[model samples]
Target: MRLPKLLLFIVLFCFVFLSGAQIQAQETNEKADAKQAEPPSSVKELKPVTTIDPLVPLDQLRIMVRPLTKDELQVEANAWFELLRNKSRQIAAARLGVKKTNEAIATNDDQQALDSLKKAESVQHMADEKARQTEEELTKQAQETLGVDVAVDAARPDPAKAEEGTTASTEEKSATTADSTSTPDNPTTTQSAEAMKAAFLQNINRLQDERTALSDRLEVVLTSLAAKGGDVETYRKYIAAVSGLELDTSDASAAWSGIKGWFVSKEGGQRMGWNLGKFLLILFLTWVVARIGSTVISWLLERKVRLTQLAENLISGTIRNVIYLVGFAVALTALEVDMTPVLAAIGATGLVVGLALQGTLSNFASGLMILINRPFDVGDVVTAGGVTGTVKQMNLVSTNFRTFDNQTIHVPNNSIWNGVITNITANKVRRVDLEFCIGYSDDFEQAEQIIRDVLADQELVLREPEAVVVTHALADSSVNIVCRPWAKTTDWWAVKTAVTREVKRRFDQAGISIPFPQQDIHVYSTDASKGNGKIETVSK
Candidate 1:
């Protein structure tokens, strides 16, 4: 009886505990629902945060939200406009931050300056990104709402337009509303859309200009901070970050924008112009110095050295070209152009050209050898490369020759150098050989004497080397007398022709017969009628 009474008491205690726990759980759920249904106490709490002061932490920068659907765009257009205005404000704040950083740097507050600069750079980047997002959203909205493709006309959104649109009076809003509610055929809606496109383009231009100005100012501050011996690595990171955020435009617009920015930004345009002017001045000075150097070298070569014309020209021209090349490199350096890539490209091009022009290169090398060896000079009569002519001109690849019969020939230097070269006018004197045929019956001594007299009468012939007149050969019908006369190289042709004409006239007057070849033929005929044929000779 005691155990049954105890079990009933425990069961009652368990039921009361379970009921109490259930009532408490219901009360807690009811309170939670009531709290969930309560509204915020202030309207300002509903607005997105837009305070991007220089003192604000970078992580707390505002994150702009773009509406993704047509209904959402309609509901959120005003909010987006406010966000765009916030972005513009952020840009302005970044500008202010840069100015403050500059001041801090001036005060030698390195840490503070670096922190401020970093914050400004971060804000600028965020603002730039938000501006791009706003532009994209505007394009999307235009396409979704008005069925107008602004991208087809290369119309882009302007960040400034957001501020302007947000600040517009109520009357403008009412007018825009009236235009939007009009029928599709109404010209006012079309006009509104067109005006919006123009505004977008104009705003984009303004935004780009403002970004350029801010970027330029920031660059100046960074430069000043670096000059002050601040933390370089930190500022360098800022520089890299800022560089990445530069506004990008279409190719045509970008070019035009750059030109406009160049003129608009005093530091950039003036600095570049100064650099360009210095580059040109240095180049001009280099050219002057190079010219003077070449002239001096030419004078020294002409007065102090006896070199071939080709060698002289080659040396002077090479020196001049090297000077010009160095000057050009220096000019490029003045303009802050990097030369490593230029030199690498030049070396690569030289190698490729060398490979493609093997035969031409062989000629060039041969020409250098010829210049060094002093084989021949301009105006010297040469017999080389299977041709005999006077050297007219020469270059690294080929030599020009004017033939005795008035024909121009271009001979590769390789051909001339690889073969035996005969320079007729290399020496002051040359020998002319002449052969005359006479009858064997005539006195050889008289013929020899006549030839000697002709050589003696020629004023151009040289007497120191003496002339030679000898019987060279005994032919079938005559004797061949050889005449060798030495003369100045310049008079070689004149002496030879005069001596030949004089010898012929003397021979005719001296009755020394010049022989001609003659032949006699004999034929025998037999009479067919005679049984014992007697051979008879017939002469005609």
Candidate 2:
């Protein structure tokens, strides 16, 4: 046993020495390769085309001072795309390295496996740096050739040049119309316009081609990365540059070096652990405080402040929710989650949601208005937004009401706010105004007295206001009487209904006539024998 242990120790020491030597040799070779493959000076060259000379004739300028050719732009774009391909290639190589590392581990070659992973990471880093420099080259080329920060196809044409073209065309048309014998036309202008159009189209096509190629390569790399999803150096090779090609990195969980990295990385492991501990402590504290805060709020509302149940619930719930959100934000920051981008994203998302849901936003605003104004409370019988119903539940977006038929109706707050709101039970007392028609011959005074008696006799009617019955109008067939009485708001409907029934009964009992609708037609006929007209009455 002593001899075997001694041999194992010697073997381990030799393996460690060999691995260090191998790593140092690999690094030297990589540096040499990097130095040899340095990018050409032309790649970094820039000749910024500041402002276009609108006065220069397109054809003349083509023959005179030299300008950058379209091929140069294509070469620059190709260079940039080549860098993208190389990046994908690096990731692919790293993936192979990961496989080799795994194989080494399965074969009990631990040092080889660790070395492989380290090499892969180093290669990925070098590749990323190269890609970054290449991106700079791409941007510089765009600035020099396009004379702007963005690509050529995205830039608008010069307004001055457009105006010049229009002016030239007008002059040409004027010349042709004035004289037919003049030089038919100069084809140079047509050539110039066509050339410009062709150039613009060519640039657009080239940009699209480059973008498509980059997108395809990015897709392939991403797909491979997804398939090889695990805690390996290969998976994270192209992680940082995924956004440029518009690939979503949210699902790149395995590339986070497993769950521990979801919070913080191993390089900052101690600090991360401390922060995580604090985060949990803060969360626990927040939860305890939130419960206490909610209880205190409810107690204040019920005992000290005095508010309705709904109002208290709304206030306490809102306060607790706000505290919860603030606590979560603090915890997230402690966990090393970037809050600035999170906040910006939230703001931008809010703007988009607001624009998309304009009607909904209006409803929310109106609900706030309704809450503040207190026009009508829940259970109030009201005519709102063209619907008459008893308000059941009033919320932020909509108000639910129960119609007379017991059917539920939901009204948007915006409509209710914009339209008229008539709360039937708004006042403590309400007046019931009713008009009754009596026949011309029957006895108007008696009918008025009967109406007053009916109103006064009603149980729900308020005696303090005193009921009034007056002759309103005397029509061709009847005398109209107005009966107005006051009652408690809750019993107004019942009193009005009862008064109507009682008035008709008392009038009939008192032999006072309530006339039905009638019309009298007069007919005139010519009598041939007497040669005179005779008139007769026809009642309807």
Taken over the whole model, the C-alpha lDDT of each candidate is 0.63, 0.61
- How many clashes does each candidate structure show, in the order listed? 1, 0
The C-alpha TM-scores of every prediction are 0.52, 0.46
Give the local distance difference test score of model 1. 0.63
Q: Model 2, residue 41: what's the lDDT?
A: 69
In the range 1-540, model 1's lDDT, one tens digit per residue, is 999999999999999999999999999999998977664354222322211111122233212122122222223333333333544555454334334434433443334433444454445445655655654554465355545544322254444454445224212532563545434334443343334323323333444444444443333333333444433355334434533223334334434544565555544566568879999998898889888988888888888997777677778877888888998899897775657568879888998888999999999999989998989988999999988999988888998999999999999999999999999899998899999999878999999998988888788999979888899899877899999999998999999899999999999999998888744455556677775555555423
What TM-score does candidate 2 get on C-alpha atoms? 0.46
Model 2 off-target regions past 4 Å? 1-317, 320-341, 357-361, 393-397
In candidate 1, stretches whose alpha carbon ends up further than 4 angstroms from where it belongs are 1-283, 302-306, 332-338, 348-353, 405-408, 441-443, 517-540
Pull out the clashing pairs in model 2: none
Output the lDDT of residue 472, model 1. 82
Q: Against the true structure, candidate 2 has what lDDT?
A: 0.61
